[model samples]
Target: MTIIDGKLTKHYARVWDYCHELLRSNPGSTVQVGVTVNPDQTTYFHKMYLCFKAIKEAIGRDASNQVYPIAWAVVDIENKANGKWFLELLTEDLNLLDGGGFTGLLEATKEVLPNVERRQCARHICANFRKTYTGMEFNNMFWAASFSTVESEFLRKMDDIKEVDPNAYENLLARHPHTWYRAFFRTDVACEAVENGIAECFNAIILDARKKPLLAMFEKLGCT
Candidate 1:
């Protein structure tokens, strides 16, 4: 389920309670929760705090069980700086590693829940690539890498690009190889699900919403 307002302590607590109850009732049953926090969104810091709290609560008090096995995905529309902010906030709050927020969360969760697997959204990764690189070559390389599952094919294209501009290859693959491109390609189906419908639907909704004043539109919809 999507928890819209992570800043509301009551709501966060309720969700945590429900998650705990669900886990307790079904021992050994794996539970996966996907969370998308837009740093540009209001109360993002609070949401990060709430996510930390949920992770801590799920793992219990013992340091041995301190690792909470929960899968969380954070989606952001801002640049890398904002993404880094969220990642830093998550690591500081949850005492995670120095890598991406999802990676840190996965490590922490695994210590307690062995079955939990964390994943990053491919859409955001693609956006990051687009933001960092400024030409069709970069775009071509990214798409080729993203769509291709075989590492050899991905690297072959990277090599092809590198032959022309070595800097591009170095820049894209400078960071963690597994986290950057392989993560998304590894689970193509998940990427397909998000890309196929959800993103388009959200874009349409956003376009429709942008045409009018948000408050007036919400009022028309009886939101308030």
Candidate 2:
């Protein structure tokens, strides 16, 4: 899981390092990481870990002009807690000893953009939920809970989750409903979006382009 962002083709670790450095060097810059994961593995590899060490060794001998720092991990599960563990390792590697510098997006957003209303993407929630719970029942119930525009309706949907599985109910309960569900969003925004579908769609459009060489990827994106 590598992602290319604008001029930087960085692995997740490199991105974390870059953000950490930028913030430390220049206090004016704002940096935040929205933690998420692909619930399923790729077709070729069923395992959840990347071979970063092997890739790093290969890169060491290569004479390429480009610099690609790799950071990989083997996680028992793909969840927010495990994601934080991966970040902790990266922080240690980057020598960000002050510890308190890194903060979750929710806290940062409140401090930096207090007036702004934040909405969690429903599709992302579904992806994370699918990690622990599956099938159409859970999916439908989850969406129902998310889409509910009334507090009573939302509670009803949650009750549905509790009926299906008390553990699943607890899981969903832990996921901060006020940010994702329709009932809790500010009415002033006049936006009813439950998911970040536009960004997802754009990523899908550039899926193949992202796997190509730098120049080739740019060319493909230009054409797209």
Candidate 3:
């Protein structure tokens, strides 16, 4: 916000200090500032990532039951470096030596979530299937492939897909059955969920905040 005629606080002006103050006030806060060296040799602001106390704790508190940010970043550029830096900081702050897990950007997850598994969103898959294939049998077979608690059941349904619609079956094969199917997910985490809607919910909660100034938005993550 511009102070057209009022007193100016360091909160909006001195970004570095503001970040430090946030860290001081909130013990578990995590903040990363990305900077780029200009041609003139001076460093300029690039982007930032902030994970407040609540999220920090959520990542570190428990193994089986934990809250994980499902693919998010604060960088202007959505490239590998930015993602790697964000996750590297997150991993350091939370001591997440292994994959803590998240949904949303599978590529971002791939950069950080090792040992942790990926689950494909069944609803999204169904939506896509509806676009390419006809008949309820395809949906039923997809569901069967996803819902199967055992390997045999999943394979049987997959075979069903191959038989019914060879083209759709080929598409399904491309998506990799292990991602959505329960028969293939790791039993370590409590999440048997095949939907990535957590990202949706998280985004909705922070959507307004995301448009706010850095400090203001960063503070919102800590409150919850």
Specify the highest-lDDT model's number.
3
lDDT per residue as tens, model 1, 1-224: 12432333454445445556546765643333335545566543222212424444222223452223222222334455444444445455455553322222233334432333343444565677668667887777776765555678778877876886777678667644454455243342232221223333434544543343322232222221
For model 2, residues 4-110, the per-residue Cα lDDT tens digits are: 43432333335455446645864543334444445664322111212223232211213553323334343435556655555554444444344333222353234
Each model's C-alpha lDDT? 0.45, 0.59, 0.66
Pairs that collide, model 3: none
- Candidate 1 overall Cα lDDT vs. reference? 0.45
Candidate 3 lDDT for residue 68: 61
Ranking by lDDT: 3, 2, 1
Find the 10 residues in a row with the least total lDDT in model 1: 215-224
Model 3: per-residue Cα lDDT over 38-129, one tens digit each: 57876454466667546544322237654466224466566787778877777676667767553323566676767546566877878887
Tell me how candidate 3 scores on lDDT: 0.66
Give the clashing residue pairs of candidate 1, or none.
67-112, 68-109
Query: How are the candidates ranked when ordered by TM-score, highest leading?
Result: 3, 2, 1
